[model samples]
Target chain A: MPTVRINDENVTFNEGATVVDAVAQTTGRELTAEGKPADGGRLGVAVALAEEVVPRSRWAGVELSEGDQLEIVTAVQGG
Target chain B: MADMSLPPLQIGGYSLESRLIMGTGGITDLAALEAALVQSGTTLTTVAMRRYSPETKTSVFSMLERLGIDVLPNTAGCYTVRDTLLTAELAREALETDLIKVEVIADEHTLLPDVIETLEATEQLAERGFTPLVYTTDDPAAARRLESAGAAAVMPLGSPIGTGLGILNPHNIELICSRASVPVVLDAGIGTASEAAAAIELGCDAVLVASAVTRAQDPTAMAEGMRLAVEAGFHSARAGRIPKRQHALASSPMEGRIDLT
Candidate 1:
């Protein structure tokens, strides 16, 4: 089992969890068939692991360990 | 409808006929915002990133999608290269676009770009193969450096953001335009129609407007004004103006002037 911090929320998951498993636990959202952090319309959310972006392609394969830091962001209004 | 006859404004792989790139901010009404988008005839516009909030949050993303308008996601409040990089990465994953408007500010009071961080972010973004439209100061030398760093566009403020002060340093804008190989964008400090014209005439490839239009009491009319102003500015630039003189060189020939004058 690994304890990872996502967007400042510390989430613990079953042992031998990948980055995908951590994201599901952290955001509590369902993954699409293509296996991305998305909800129907895709909030345009981006995820970063350890300050480096975890590309969507590699999300399923990259495993997470204890204390790994994650950041999730989405598009908002601005000038 | 935007006139398609104008010479296209090209940035990276995108080419837009309209030189006005509007910002989706200030105005709270969604319908009115859509109306303003159409009125402005802007091919590209900006949106900022925020932490996701689901319960009370409705998607402006859907509204933009319905309008079929392309979005240029921005890092509006990022204070450092690290924050900006993450924000930009999020925007890309969420928006599925490479277009980013990089705004790395030093503080909220000034809302101005931090020169050192802006430069650093631009170089890194380019290295990562993302197209960055950097918001930089009006320093021509810095503008050159940003271009060298592979910025898709160099957007320099005419003054501070939202001040409506117009172009406080026209010469610097002109100087930046004169040297830049990439498009020079006049961003922020635009208060009215003429300033937009001046920015275009000074050789800016495009103008990014927000408060001057979206916040106007008459936003719809203001939006139209911006559209026409951008075209007029581009036209005037192409038409070419006579050199400024200390004394008037009479438009009417000397011989045509009345002797009584």
Candidate 2:
């Protein structure tokens, strides 16, 4: 099992799991490699792993490592 | 003059139809925020990035999409260059736009922009192919440095964020607007529609309002008022106001007043 910190919460994933896997599990929305919802809807989400922004195209290729810190963010009401 | 129209605001690669840029903050109700957005007639609106929560649905992005308003992602709560850059990167990815509002605050107490960090962030973001709209203090020198640092637009605060105190230093704002090569957007502390108008009158290219409209008692009405005010302000700015003097000038014919004597 690979343990990772996602949005400040610890979560253990199966071996060879990737960033998309974590996002799909946490958001409950199956996402494409482009990070769009598989249902052809706008996801409006972005991911940062270890404080480095991970582009949507590389979400699946970047495997989760032990103690990996991930941040998934979306739009909120702000100035 | 009756058929005159205000020119569109050109910032970076976008040509904004409205000079009043609305901020979608402090409005808890999504429906109300939508209404305000529509009523404001703003071609662009700003949104902040935060952690995603499944329980709390975010229709903000979808709503903006439906309304056809371009999103300007901001680094609102970031206090350092590292955090600001990360936030900006996330915003660029999430929003799929190169437009970023570089807001590096010094502290939470005053919510004033850290000019040094903001300058650094602007330089880096611009280098990364992002159109950085740097929010800064109403200091002419700082504004000039940010412009030189590759900011697409310079947004100088009239007062602290969320204060609604209005433009405290009109002279400084005027100076910044006059000297800047890029667009000058009056960012914070606009309390009413008049202040939005005042910004344009003071040579500001645009005005960004958040708390003034979002936290108003009647958000929709205030938004509409702001729309009208911005238009009026634009026209007034070009209309050329009368010069100030210690002595009052009579509007009526001075020669026709002899009958009263």
Candidate 3:
């Protein structure tokens, strides 16, 4: 089991876990997990791993390694 | 009439026709951006990556290219060196240009560049052969350091990114100009034509703005005003200023004058 660090918080994942999956599991917030209220539903999440922007669709295919830093950014609307 | 010769300014090996560098964001559309660019007479325009849709190639790049203007791609939303570098690489590939507008923002509220991360990204980009146009704060020392680190130009913010507060620190901007060997372009917080003019008058080589022109009531008209303001600022800078005098000098012969009855 390889460990991953996201924004300095450490999390464990099974072998061959994608960066997106690891983030969703660690945060308890569904990235692709949809169907909630408009204000409370998960809008979208953008992942930046090792300083490269990985598109949402490609996040599932991206293989993660130990010591890889990831940034999971979610968008929120404001007036 | 007087001689109208002015020295030319070079940036990233390109001879700029004007010191006003426009941004491609916040416009109604590509047509409006083109019109504004034409009216401003700026050779370079900043384009952000986040605004681009990867799904569709329909973008302002082709439009700006058709207008015969140079594109300076910006890393507007990047907060780290790695993100900035990646964005720069992507921009280079997409735009087919090595010129980059590097913005490492630590705080979204202030839109201020993270000096440490910005310098780090700058060093990496410079090593990798990217001409980084850094958007920094109005700090003279930081501007000098950026120039020393191989920045194509130092773009200090007049205030925040879109507040249009104008030049909050003219003295610091002047200091940056006096210290740096590269061009000093005022990057943000410019709300009107006068702010652009003031930046140029403070010895900045150029002004990079978006909302001021694109979000105005009439984009084309505001663009024209910005053009004239930049021109006026350039002329004023070249014309120099009247030296301040501490004591008054007698215009007439006051010491030898006779009293009248």
- How does each model score on lDDT? 0.83, 0.92, 0.76
Query: Which model is ahead, 2 or 3, in terms of TM-score?
Result: 2
Q: What is the per-residue lDDT of model 1 for residues B1-261, given as tens digits with 9 covering 90 to 100?
A: 756466877887777667888888888787888888889988788999876556313256667777777889999989999999888888888788888999999899999889899999999998987889999999998899889988999999998999999999999999999888999999999999899999999999899999998889988899899989988898889887878889966566666555663
Q: After superposing candidate 3, which stretches have Cα over 4 Å from the reference?
A: A1-79, B1-7, B51-56, B245-261
RMSD of 1: 3.6
lDDT of 3 by residue, A42-68 (tens): 222345677676655576788788888
- Model 3 C-alpha lDDT per residue in residues B1-261, reported as the tens digit of each score: 976644567877767676788886675566776788899887888876542122323346556666787778788888999878887775665456778889999988877899989988998999999988899989999988888888989999999887878999999999999888898889998999999999998999988878898888888999999988988888988888877899997678768678789
Kindly provide the TM-score obtained by chain B of candidate 2 when compared with the true chain B. 0.96
Ranking by lDDT: 2, 1, 3
Best by lDDT: 2
Q: Model 3 TM-score?
A: 0.72
lDDT string for model 2 (A1-79, tens) is: 9999999999999999999998888888988866678998677889999899999899999999999999999998899
lDDT of 1 by residue, A1-79 (tens): 7888877878887777777665565456777535564656554566788778887667778888899888766666678
Query: What TM-score fits each model?
Result: 0.86, 0.96, 0.72
Q: DockQ (Cα-based) per candidate?
A: 0.51, 0.80, 0.05
Deviation from native of the Cα of residue B18 in model 3, angstroms: 1.9
Candidate 1 — which residues are off by over 4 angstroms? A1-4, A10-30, A36-43, A62-68, B1-4, B55-58, B245-261
